[model samples]
Every structure is written in C-alpha cells, then in structure tokens.
Target: MKLVRYGAPGAERPGVLDAQGRVRDLSMLLAEMGPAQMSPRTLAALATIDVERLPLADAGVRLGCPLGGVGKIVCVGLNYRDHAQEAGMAVPAEPVLFMKAVTALSGPYDDVQIPPGAQKVDWEVELGIVIGTRLKHVKKEDALGHVAGYVLANDVSERAYQTERGGQWDKGKSYDSFAPVGPWLVTADEVGDPHALDLWLDVNGQRMQDGNTRDFIFDVPTVLSYISGFMTLEPGDLVLTGTPAGVGLGQKPQPRFLRAGDEMRLGAAGLGEQCLKCVQS
Candidate 1:
C-alpha cells in the first residue's frame, strides 16, 4: 500500500492512496505513519481496512512528508561510482556516512530556501530507506529485514559550507528545507529489486541528473548493515543512499548552482516524485 500524509504543512493528517490513485483519509484508523504504524504487524492490520470506503481527499490539498517522528537522517556519500569519479574521489571500501539535522526535513513539495550567505547550492536525488525496527551488528544478509519502506529525497547542499569552510559535510548538508522527503512511503514488498530502479533530477525543467541505482557501489543491505555495526539503528531512522552523477558541481565548462527562483523535481521509480522551488532565505 502507498501510505501518505496530506493537507497543509503542519496540519497534515494521515492518509493512503486508494486503488484508483485517489488520496483517502486514514485519520479514523490510525494516528500517523510512524515507527509504531510502520511495524510489520501494524501494517498488516491496516491492510484489512477497505481504502475505497475512506473519504476521498480533495486533489488540490498539499502533500506533506509521508512519515512522522523522524529520529535521524543519516546520509551516505559517494555511494555511486560515477558520482565518486565526477567528484574526483576514489570509491571507498565502506559507506561514507554523515548526518543531516532533522530540522532540515520539509514536505516534498515545499519551497527550498537558499540560506543567507549561501552560494553553490546543489541538488542530489536519492533513494531514502526508512527503518522499521531497532538493529545493531546485523549481518548484510539480514539488514534489509529492518527496513520499513522507501521514499524519494532531495539532499540539497551548500558547497562552500560543505568544503571550503573546513569541517564535516554535515555543516553544508543540514540546513532548513534541505531534505525534502516523501510524497509517499512505499512498503518494501511493493518495491521489488530496489537496486534496479531508475532515478533522475531536473532543475528548472532542464534534466541535470539521470542515473540508475544499479551503479551504486554499496547496495541497500550492505549500507544498512554497515551503519548498524557502529550505531544502533532505531525505528523512524532514515538512511539516504547517495545520489548519482550529473550534479551541478560535477558539470563541465562551468558549475551550475541553484539560485533563487530555481526549481527541482526528482523521483525514484514507484516511490513517486517531488517538485520543489528555491527561494531566497
């Protein structure tokens, strides 16, 4: 089932997409899509409800981040070989991890604010994995079993703060509205072969990044297990598998960074798409 949250930004209520692709209210059945609701047993129970019978929401309503109670937003860097090559870096033997402040979270379609004193804003289209259960020191073979689902995410970055300032990438990555996630949370069962999906990004109607997950140097199970080895993975934690090649900074001739009034649209196959506009902070 494609679960979602809809309505205004802070007032969004729980919802699910019905068979006809219409947004149906799930308020009466559950509080929201969080760790508790995403558990295998809870999701199994929600499957019994007749989605068609739920009230159809007005198509004009705005969509919000699909899940609530996001605990941590972990990111993997240079997970794609082509991306690593473009950035002039060697593919690491282990996943390069970083953290994006949870405050960076915003509705998928919300405006992306170019922070004050910021230049070289860039876009990264990635596949985000949502954890459903606690896990630590799990084997690669069993890593994916802890995932609740997947969603589309835009890992917006500020190059100057990320590289020139002399600190971890986290400083450049964790900004308000930097992490636009959702449209919907697609369960793992419905997303077969996660590594084979096609993903792309466009800036102001111009296709900038076009790549497939098959190019990932570290696959889903490996990434999850690797991270869990160092830290306990809790429910509601999100892991953003890195973006592919074609980011603005990697462009030839000249770099094309995001500016005020720029727009970005990105998506992963089956997870749905996100349309965000950039505005001055």
Candidate 2:
C-alpha cells in the first residue's frame, strides 16, 4: 500500500492511495502517520483496511512528508561505488554515516530555497529507509525486519559549506528544504527488493543522475545494522542510503549548480517521484 500525507504543510492529514491512484483519507483511522504507526504490526493492520471505502481527498491536494514526527535523519555517504569513483574517493570498509537535521525535511514537490550566498548547490537521488521498530546492535540479517517503508529522497547539498567551510558535512546538508522526500511511503512488503530499484534525477529537464540501488557499496541491511550498533535506531528515523554518480559536483568539464528557478525531477521505481523548484530564500 502507498501511504501518504495530504493537505497544507502543518495541517496535513494521513492518507492512503487507492487502486485508482487516488488519495483515500485515513484520518479516521490514524491521527498521524508518525512513529507509533510505523511498526510492523501497525502497518500490517493498516494494510487490511479497504482503501476504496475511505473518503477521497480533494484532487491535486498538496503532499507533505509522508511520515510525521521523524527522528534523526541519518545518511550514508559515498555508499555507491560509482559515486565514490566520481568523487575520487575509495569505498570505505564500513558505512560512512552523517546526520541531516530533521528541519531539512520537506514535501517531495516543495520548492527548495537556496540559502543566502550559497553556491555549489547540488542534488543526490537516493533510496530512503524508514525505521519501523527500535533496534540496537541488530545483525544485518535482521535489520530489514525493522524497516517500515521506503521513499525516494534528494540530498541537496552546498559543496562550499560541506567541504570548504565545514567542520562536519551537516553544515551544508542541514539547510531547510535540503531533504525533500516522499510522494508515498511504500510499504516494505510492496517494495520487495529495495536494493534493485532504479533511481534517477534531472535538473531543469536534463537527465543528470541515473543509477540503480544495486550499485550500493554498502547495501541497506549493512548500513542499517552498522548504524544501529553506534546509535539506537528508532521508529520513523530516516536513512538516506546514498546516491549513484551524476551529481552536479561530478559533472563533466565543469561543475553545475542550482540557481533560482531551476527545477529538479527525481524518482525511484515504485517509490514515486519528486519535482522541486529552486528558489532564493
């Protein structure tokens, strides 16, 4: 089932997509699609609801981040071999982890504001994992069982702040609108094989990044398990499992960056799509 949140930004209501590709209100059933509703049991229960009977949302309603009350947004850097090669970095033995401030979260199609004086703004299309259960030091074999769902994400970055003026990558990664995720929170059962999905991103109608999750140097389970060992993985925690090559910083001849009015379109097969406009703050 495709889970969603619809309506205005803060007042968005929980919804599920019906077979006709229409929004079906889940407001009467779930107050918010937050941590409490992310567990395997909760999701299983939700799956049993007859979406056809639920109230249909207004046509063309705005979609907000699919899951609410999200915890820390953890990201794996250079987890894709191609991305590592393009960036002139070697693949690490362990997952490279970083934090993206939760405040950076925005709707999939929302306008992404370019922070003042920022240059080198870039895009990274990646598979996002949503934790469903509390986990600590989980084994890789068991890690996937704790996942609630999957969503596509764009890890927008400012290279100057990230590599030049930064102590940690968070300085460049944590800007508001930097992490636009979800058109739907596809259930784990529906996704089936997260590592095999094809993902791509385009800037202003030009295809820039085109890659598959199968190229991930450290796959989802490994990244999740590794993260759980260092810090507890709680429900609703989002993990961006890295992007394949073709980011603006890795462009041929010269690097390209986002300017006001630039548009971005990206998606992962089955996870849905995101279309964003870059705007000056």
List clashing residue pairs in candidate 1.
Answer: none
TM-score of predicted structure 2: 0.99
- Candidate 2, residue 112: lDDT: 96
Q: lDDT by residue for model 1 over 1-281, one digit each (tens)? A: 89998988778899999988889999988877777887888877878888889999998678888988898999999999999998999989889999999999999899999999788999999999999888899999998888888999999999889999997999999999999999889988888788999999999898999999998899999999999988998988899999999998999988889999988988889999999999999
Which candidate ranks first by lDDT, i.e. highest? Answer: 2
Superposed Cα deviation of residue 39, candidate 2 (Å): 1.0
Cα-based RMSD of the predictions, in order? 0.9, 0.7
TM-score of 1: 0.98
Q: List candidate 1 stretches off by more than 4 Å.
A: none
Provide the lowest-lDDT 10-residue window in model 1.
29-38
Can you give the TM-score per candidate against the true fold? Answer: 0.98, 0.99
Q: Give lDDT tens digits, candidate 2, residues 124-240.
A: 999999999998999999999999999989999999999999499999999999999999999999999998999999998999999999888988889999999999989999999
Scanning candidate 2 in windows of ten residues, the lowest lDDT window is 85-94
